[model samples]
Target: MEQLLTVKKGNSRTTKIDVEGVYYRDLNAQLRELSSKGIQNVQLLNVYGQRYIGTNLSQPMEIEISGTPGNDLGFLMNGSKITVYGNAQDGCGNTMDDGNIVIHGHAGDILGMSARGGKIFVRDDVGYRAGIHMKEYQDKKPIIVIGGTTQDFVGEYMGGGILIILGLNLSEEKTYRAKFVGTGMHGGVIYLRGKVEQYQLGKEVGIAELEEKDYRVLHDNVNEFASYFNLEPNKILEHQFIKLFPRWLRPYGRLYTY
Candidate 1:
């Protein structure tokens, strides 16, 4: 039997919850209740492995987490703002439709598995397949800006949207180590800072030279990432970056067509 979390009113519009041992189901239920009551600001402290923290939210609300959150931290979240003070597990933004998620620490594999809207900013490295299958929704393009490099398959099977990776923690050599990047990508773009060898890319991927428009996009998104982590956009944008695109619109269209 799980007990309901005792919601402490931080102020007239803010609520605080200490989710140390509470079940994820009860925690979310309380959150739904809070949202129903028009509570817009929530602070979760001592959180540990609480899955789906803001998945049910479909409106604009602000949530702050203190400890590590479990998988699918903001699954299908819409128009919510989640700020994690610590790390996050796999499927952080799986199928998320809208809103913002800011992580101060590292994230696990498949960071934004199938997100379609809003922005996610991380201050540290990420695991494999950070932006796998990320697409856009209407005029809203899902944006993922990683402060540090990710493992293999950073943008695997990405269909649409923007994926920005800044290798801020590479060794002095300044060479990327991830391989098979954009393995099954069909659409969208990948902006990676640092050097990646030709052999490191997948057969379906191609490198293209950046244009004036590309620089403007980088300038704006880098500033967004910098604002989150208190970094200087100029210092990061000064590094050499590469643009990776899919070689074909349908890399494997023939596989299932006939």
Candidate 2:
């Protein structure tokens, strides 16, 4: 049994939910029910470590989460927009097909793992293997922007899409801390705004000069990210950026016996 309460706000039809002592399943059930009834905006309060907060939701709604959410926050989500005012746990956008996830604080490991389409913006640091195995097809391409530095294996096995690491909090001379970056990445590009030593990159990845199209992509995404966190986009874009891409389409193709 779960105890939850909902209150309707004036005019806007926004529903506020108090999820104290409510099970994750029950909470998600209520969310689905509300969305099915054409409720487009919801605010969840007292959400302490509830896993799968917005999993597999395809409706075009806005969900505001106030407390720290547990793992798999928006797994396989489509069309819904989720804004987390607090920190998020591991696998934030696992295989998400569409929508936006804006995190005000840090995020855990494997953020945006294998997301096919959508955007994820983190205002602070992220843990290991952020953006691992992400891919894109046709008009659907995922994008992830991290404001702070990350741990090891960032963008490991990424097949497509865009990844941006702003490194805003780091000193000008300090190199990025992540190692084995873009390991086994075959497609897509990664934009890093800080120093990275040669040893930090995987052998399969190579650095390239930014082109006009690349600049456009960075400008749009960085501007959006800066606007979300109330930072100046110009100051963030003033620094140099390095592009990382795979040297070969299949780095391990020779390893397999075909």
Candidate 3:
């Protein structure tokens, strides 16, 4: 793999890399080197489907990706901010510990699978099984806010964290179309802006009215998401929202005998 790393020093604490056709390994190696050199910010141009672009990066740096990134874009990333100008592929933030990933466009399936901490904001719709198995610890909780609607199984087997579906593009009268939502969900909460029918949800999931705390969470996250995608937060929040949570601590606890 040819290492095409062009480090052009900007005004202060910024480095720009023209990663047109650089291999993933070489690109990551150069990125690590740049981070070690105290480069606080990095801008990658023409970043097309480079898997693991910001994997396991523990630095508190800011990385801006111009084009679409491949799967596992920020896997296990500890502390950093990644802003993607274009859409992203599957598993964007797989098992991320702590950080922020802001996607200006749509994302693929399993958006935040098992992410222990951090936040993922998707401007448009996503594929199936988003927020699958996402969990949280004592103080660390992951959050994912989808600006548009999604496909089936939005929060399958989620253990913890918060998932919000804004449904900004859907009409007011249209019910949420996703099926088998929150299937086997044990923990966490999913908020949907539009109405959902009882048949569309899993047996273990139950609907609830949005509380004051729910509004606060939605306000904070939606505001942040709107700022990233240049949308009006107030208009987005004007619609009514509903919450989905697991009815039983162990949905399948009866299947096995100890």
Candidate 4:
């Protein structure tokens, strides 16, 4: 008898994992047979508020959840890789189409909502529209990396990929609690660190500083989000990173069509 399952506590919607004691007797079909048996490091003894924990996996496994995981945790995922220690709710990786989801603690609200591909790494501090309406196809570019400090519309209406928000220490109090950032953004790219004054972004979008090929893709995505949440990647490269796109919108002489 090489099977150990335990999810004996309540209120979860779409679970499945068909085997290995099967959640000690059908805990939503053992979370859908561990999302169709690509179980790589499954150790979730007693997860409580489970809702779509690793939904619709394709392959590539790695799920290690503990507690407090509800509300679209990897909803519509393609490929597979999930890691959550605690504190996750509301669209953690909803609409994901690739792999990689890591939330050590703290996350709620549209955290990578409408993702069209993969990559979501959040160490802490997240809530409100964190990468809301994120999208990207063609190259399938989807990436959201948040270390700390996020609230309000982090990247609303982003029609592409690459959104990074890092605050870490979180309060020199200049600007962290973002508001109305990138409203109706026609494309992608949103990276914020600190010192935004009163932080009110929208109106198409236009902000700069941080080139050199976007500092090598934000220093390789903040050094892989501080090496997967361990921190101290030169104090996140000593701050100062704010870049949003989509500004020069001069399509044609649109008084009337030609």
Q: Which candidate has the highest lDDT of all?
A: 2
My TM-score estimates for the predictions, one after another, are: 0.93, 0.95, 0.94, 0.35
Q: Could you tell me which 10 consecutive residues in candidate 4 have the lowest summed lDDT?
A: 12-21
lDDT of 3 by residue, 1-258 (tens): 333354555654556787888888888887787777777688888888888988755466789999988899888888889999999899999998889999999999999999999999999999999999999878899999999888899999999999999988788577578999999999999999878899999899999999999999999999999999989999989888999999999898899988
Clashing residue pairs in all predictions, respectively, total 0, 0, 0, 11
Residue 28 local lDDT, model 3: 86
Clashing pairs in 3: none
What are the per-model C-alpha RMSD values against the true structure?
Answer: 2.8, 2.0, 2.2, 13.5
Model 4, range 56-149, lDDT digits (tens) per residue?
6555566777666678887888767788878888888888888889888888889878899899988888888888878897889889888877
Tell me the spans in candidate 4 whose CA falls farther than 4 Å from its real position. Answer: 11-32, 36-63, 66-76, 79-81, 86-100, 105-121, 124-145, 148-159, 170-186, 195-243, 246-258
TM match of model 2 to true structure? 0.95
Model 1 TM-score, all chains together: 0.93
TM-score of model 4 (CA atoms): 0.35
In model 3, which runs have C-alpha deviations exceeding 4 angstroms? Answer: 1-12, 172-175
Give the Å shift of residue 7 in candidate 3.
9.9
Report the error of model 2 at residue 226, Å. Answer: 0.7
Error of 3 at 62 (Å): 0.7
Query: For model 2, what is the error of residue 177's alpha carbon versus the real structure, in angstroms, after optimal superposition?
Result: 0.9
